[model samples]
Target: MPHLTIVANIKANADKVDLVKSELLKLIDPTVAEPGCVQYDLHQDNDDPAHFLFYENWESRELWQMHSNSNHVKALAAATEDAIEELSIYEMTKVH
Candidate 1:
C-alpha cells in the first residue's frame, strides 16, 4: 500500500490553539487502530505555536475516506470550531 501524508495548518486565537492541539491529541489511539491506518502522529511547530500538523499513514485511500466520516473526527471538528481562526488541510502522497 502507498503512504499518505496530511498537512494541517491552523491559526488560532491565543490559548485556543492549545485547546485544539489537546483535542487532536485525543484522537491518536483511535486513529492508529482504524482499518487502514499504519501510523498517526501529531506535531507542533516550536517557533510557531499556531502551526500544527497531523502525519498519518494509511493502508489505502479508502481507509482515509472512512476516517473523514468517522464520529471521532466529527467530534474533533466540533471541539475545534470555536478555537480555529483558520484551517487548511493538504492530502498528498510521498514522492520518494
Candidate 2:
C-alpha cells in the first residue's frame, strides 16, 4: 500500500497559543505509538508563535483515518475549538 504524508496547519488565537500548544502536545506520544505511524512531528513558526504545524507520515491511509478518529485527537479538537483561529489538514503523496 502507498504511504501518506499529512500536513496539518493550525493557528491559535493569540491569547490562547499556550493552551492550544498544550493540547496538541498531548497527542504526540500516543500518536507515535499507533500502528503504521512512520513519523509525527510538530513545529511552531518562529515568526508567529501562534502558528503551528504537524508533519506526519503514515504507512497507509486507513491507519491515518484511525488515528484521526482516536480519542486523543478528539480531545485535542474539543480543547482547541475555541482557542483555534484556523485549522487545516492536507494529505499528500510523493512522486518519484
Candidate 3:
C-alpha cells in the first residue's frame, strides 16, 4: 500500500458548498479506517472555493481499489457529480 491523494475541481461553485463539505467530513473517518487505508482527509482551498483535495494513505493498491468500489464512495460521487469538473489521483510512497 502507498499514499494516495485525490484532488477534484468542481464544475461550478454551488450553493451547497457547506453541505458538500459536511458530507466530505462524514466520509473521512470511515474511508481512512477502511481496509488498506491508513488515513483519509479532506482539504478546502480558501483561494479557490471550488477546489477540494482528498488526502488518503492506503496499505496497498489492491485495498485502495476496494475502497474505490465502496458504497460510500459511490454516494460521495453521486453527491458531487454535478459539481465535479475534473478529478486527479496521485500515488506516492515514503522514501525516508
TM-score top scorer: 2
Per-model lDDT: 0.82, 0.96, 0.70
lDDT of 3 by residue, 1-96 (tens): 335544334323466677577667778777867877777767888887766787767777788888889989899888877666556776667766
Give candidate 1's error at residue 1 in angstroms: 4.3
What are the per-residue Cα lDDT tens digits for candidate 1 across 1-96? Answer: 467777667676677877988888888988888898887878888988877777777777788889989999999989887888888878889888
Could you tell which candidate, 2 or 3, scores higher by lDDT?
2
Candidate 2 overall Cα lDDT vs. reference? Answer: 0.96
Q: For model 1, where is the 10-residue window of minimal lDDT?
A: 1-10
Candidate 1's C-alpha runs over 4 A off are none
Pairs of colliding residues, candidate 1: none
Regions of candidate 3 where Cα sits further than 4 Å from its true position: 1-16
Of 1 and 3, the candidate ahead on TM-score is 1
Order of candidate numbers by TM-score, starting with the best: 2, 1, 3
Q: What's the C-alpha lDDT at position 71 in model 1?
A: 91
lDDT at position 81, candidate 1: 79
Clashes of 3: 3
